[model samples]
Target: MPLLPTPSYTTSLLLSNGHVQTLYPPLFRKVAILDAERVRIATHDDDFLDLDFLPATAEAACPNADGVRARPLVIISHGLEGHSRRKYVRGMAACMNAAGWDVCAWNFRGCSGETNRALRMYHSGVTDDLHTVISYCAERGYARIALAGFSMGGNQILKYLGEHPAAVHPAIVAAATFSVPCDLVGAAKVLDRPSNSIYMRYFMRSLKEKMRKKKELHPELNIEGLDDMKTFAEFDNQFTAPIHGFRDAMDYWQRCGCGQFLSALRVPALLVNAKNDPFLSPTCYPVYTARASEFLHLEMPVTGGHVGFIRNHEDGCYWSDLRAVEFLRQHL
Candidate 1:
């Protein structure tokens, strides 16, 4: 029953090609999100996370005015190199806010346009920062919480929920995710292909810049051959693995990939990974895992590409936005 129907998702006009669907939203989609009230919270690791709150405009939805409003809140986590205000994050925030749900879009370490104090940047499996955001919202008094994430953020949410299902927060009722790379090793192989070089270069450019900043801040850290490195494999092997305590890139992927953890999930989680997503490999679909689990629902649409569920709706809501709100409403 958890494996969902994919026909529910229809691509926007002329966005049938996988790459076209993947590239269209970031290049052309501009959504006007609700006004955000920003807040910064501390992490247990001596760093911080910036949270952008878009409160529901109900009669009494303010955070901790008298008490946290009894509204259900959707906490959104963004993708790799993504922050709270990215078009995709804000677009979903706008859609959810219109449906009367409070929104908290949290930024990963160093992603809020500020250099983080920690030497290590965010990774696919870093759930502690997410836990900090979730704990903040839960303690603030919101009665219900639903989680939504894209790409890396989605992987983090899945890993967090499945890592200790019996210990998950009570208020976190459901999760909805899109364009998730549940299998990092396989996904990386696909990403390394020449056909996906454009996306790879985009990622590498930002990553290299961040490493340069790290080098400037922590001269003791070694980054001697950083420039020559071009692929995620080379970069993650040298930096992402050792700094984050993984033995190697393969070790990082095996430990962090959410596919292995789905069976332990206790809450309802709908992972919508587009069949045409240029970022994923065949192992990412996780059809067998979802079929074996009661809580994990995997939906693979034939057309929508990486985070691209573009639907030219009169309301400006894409298929993903509509589907997320619908699924969350059913469970919340």
Candidate 2:
């Protein structure tokens, strides 16, 4: 892909206390490093379902006891069938918290074992809930906000950042994503592989259980037809697309995919994935771009499995935690 052009000096905003700069050295200059002292904080459940939001203390050095000023906030979003407590999310949250940042691991609509009340479901590229959370922070006067997501959540973050661009809340300084499925169709095809059956089955079980509960709550909606359907495609077609207003599964994936939207991104965003991530097929990796855009960068590593950047596999000192916080520190 063509290298993105560097951003020119633009209007700058300076906050009091010599903190907060609108521009920074290029993202490439920030080396991925690791940190410790990540602390686990409080967790809360969203209003709808057992969906829990784990808001951890990313940087205890800065406190929010007064609800006024604190360290910048980094919202963590998990991948499909994952939760805020996942090792990756927790690790990253703690790492950033140790570095003086507040962190919250957002549980997607119904991923935390609780069913959302609304008929509309969560999907790649849906930004309503994310926008809601960011606006909540902005309204509270948080000067800086950052986002980090993995796998499917990565896709959602990328789409939101790219689509909103100039419209995004000014507090959002930077965003980073890992194992993002830029092309949903490509990912779906890859997940259909025989080796991926285990992963697919696990997601399918969680999804069907949620649907069964929804059916129980609203007995009028006949969902018995879903009993025979197996694949993620069929499940999405029967439930996700129709409820979310998509014409079909293919349409949903196309509209929700992040690949076509990167050129519009305005925030400093980092996209990272390993060549071995199980979710991506060879065709899904971004192609060389002819136009250099300053808004986005792609960091493709040779290892890092699907959302599994197991830090220092040998010494047990993985680098994900540090990479996450450093990315935030660079832009926020």
Candidate 3:
């Protein structure tokens, strides 16, 4: 199938209240974006803190007119092996901040190259940490909260909303997830395809290195048989599943998969995905499940290349970040 055509972005959106409103300019696309500066908020010693919170500082170029405290909080979640410093994350943060929202990008456990100290590593369905982050925001009196996640982070956000619909605090008004892996097992198969093996190798190398680092801290971590494991399934079965307390990769996929969670999501959500994403096959697309949810708005763009939606042409303008901002503006 040909890739989904890229959509044009406009500033105006029609809201449910029968009013058309203009969103802030997409300053994030213009700015060079910022490098991540880390801040350590809490230690794992506290009951709520399992890993140190390394919140990335915003570029400050897109300050909200409503003042920092009054704006809605936009929480960004990065994909596997990615940190808050990624250019896309920074771009998204800048867009949200420009749109009168305070933005914070979260670094998953051990993702910022810091050892988590805990035996368990972060997984796609790990929503407790996200909940804690939301609580931190709520306590600071940010009455409105929204989320945007890339890839694995996307999977986590959808799962989080579904798993804790009733328990989610009132502050979280809506969310947007991009390039999500709706079916992990099916996605694993896609990654194993000849066309996508390069991506598979890249991800597995990072994952294996993390495991190797973990093995260094604890000699008896039992990673002896994983040297030849090339597939995502093999890696997850050996490391991700066992360490995270799941029975196996299939069990993890079955429980953590986000496709089944669409029906339960009450908040307005924009799920943007790429049909050509290397991590997922055609079967991995959750079109049917997404269509079932009145609250879910799905956008499957043709390109993007597994969150690599730089959207720049041979010369001049690009539109991925702008489109993302526009989608959020329309929904939230």
Residues 1-332, candidate 3, lDDT per residue (tens digit)?
11223444222122111111101112223445444435544534342232222222343323345534545667889887887766667767766655666676878878876767667878888888788778776665667778888889989888888876898777887787777888877877776888666567877888888888888877879898777878878888888899888999989988898877876887777777765565766655667666677677777765555664554333222355566666667645
Model 2 over residues 1-332: C-alpha lDDT tens digits? 33433312122232111111101211111323333322222223334422222333434434466755556778888888777766667667766665777666667776665666666667886786777767765655577889988888888888888877777877889987888889898899988888677677878888888888888666776587776766879988888888889899999988999888888888888777666677787655664531366767777665556765543333322355566666678787
Model 1 per-residue lDDT tens digits across residues 145-255: 999999999999999999988778888999999999999999999999999999999999899888888888788878889889889989999999999999998999999
Query: What is the TM-score of candidate 3?
Result: 0.81
Local lDDT at 268 for model 1:
95
Model 2 alpha-carbon miss at residue 75, Å: 0.5
Clashes of 3: 2
Best by TM-score: 1
User: For each candidate, what TM-score against the reference?
Assistant: 0.97, 0.79, 0.81
Per-model CA lDDT versus the true structure: 0.89, 0.67, 0.67
TM-score order of candidates, best first? 1, 3, 2
Q: Give the C-alpha miss distance for residue 140 in model 1, angstroms.
A: 1.1
List the candidates ranked by lDDT, beginning with the highest: 1, 3, 2
